[model samples]
Target: MLFLKLLGAALTLAGTARLGRLLGGRYASRTREIGRWRTALSILATELGFGALVLTQALERMALAVGGHPGGVARRAVALLHEGESSAAAAWRQAVTEASPRCSLTPEDEATLLDLGVYLGATDQEDQLRHLKLAEERMVGSERVARGEQAQRERLLGTLGWITGVLIVLMLL
Candidate 1:
């Protein structure tokens, strides 16, 4: 499981870097010829979006491994809670702190932490809730920035597509 997670991280990084370089090159050429600031901005946005997507996917996979099956970390934590081995808050905090460092948490890990924190808090685990909230805040900021960039790219692409269509129509005439 650990190996798989590591492999996923490596692949995500490689893919993101390759895509960024390809888009950046295209943006540079377009900007040089047309001086369209939107093109460069769009490229930057696309890169950010791509990076977020890759990280999100990886984190989602990790979250599933933790929360999904009977043998998962979440299940084990719950079991500990039931067995009176630890309070839910303590169990959650331990699980997150231990897992975060070992798993080399990506941005998506924040989302998982936020969800788990809320759950722990609901179950009367205030300390875990506090830490999870902090993690959530951090992740939310990054996500918002990434989303803003993605929205800009989408708008720019739409404008470019319309202009291209108009040019094609003129040529056809």
Candidate 2:
């Protein structure tokens, strides 16, 4: 499912870029008046950027699903929770890193981690709270970046459509 979503995002990016280029060219030729090249370049850049963001997020999500705290760390955390060996936070951190050191957890993951940590008595509750806050900030940043890219792509496509329509109307007249 993650792979499919990533693939679809990639295809969307490519299609948007191609459509932008086609429309940009037509607009440039018709207007013969202003910054056609700049507009085209901007459209291309925005499309690529959006595609990269989607790909990166999708890849991260896939990695987390494959090797998150639940897979290994969660088990240890649960064990610690039951055995009273350590706290939930500590067990989660240890298990997650053990399973996959490369994991970049999201805000939701951090909340789960903190809850596990407290449940297991792994570390200070404050520390878990801090981690959760940081995760929230990161998630917000990622969301904003993604939204910006999406908006740019839509704007370019809309402009292209408008230009095409105008051209057709002119021809009909």
- Per-residue CA lDDT of model 1 for 1-173, tens digit only, reads 87775665555555545555554444333223222112222322233234333322323333343332212444445545667767555765565555454332344643455355444434333443354445545545544544554556545655555555455444544
Residue-level lDDT tens digits of model 2 in 88-137: 45655665556444343434534544543343322344543354344444
Candidate 1 residue pairs in clash (backbone atoms < 3 Å): none
lDDT of each candidate versus the true structure: 0.43, 0.43
Best by TM-score: 1
Where does candidate 2 have its weakest 10-residue lDDT segment?
32-41
- TM-score per model over all chains: 0.30, 0.27
- Which residue runs of candidate 2 sit more than 4 Å off their true CA positions? 1-122, 157-173
Task: Give the 10-residue window scoring lowest on summed lDDT in candidate 1.
Answer: 33-42
Q: Model 2 misses residue 160 by how many Å?
A: 6.5
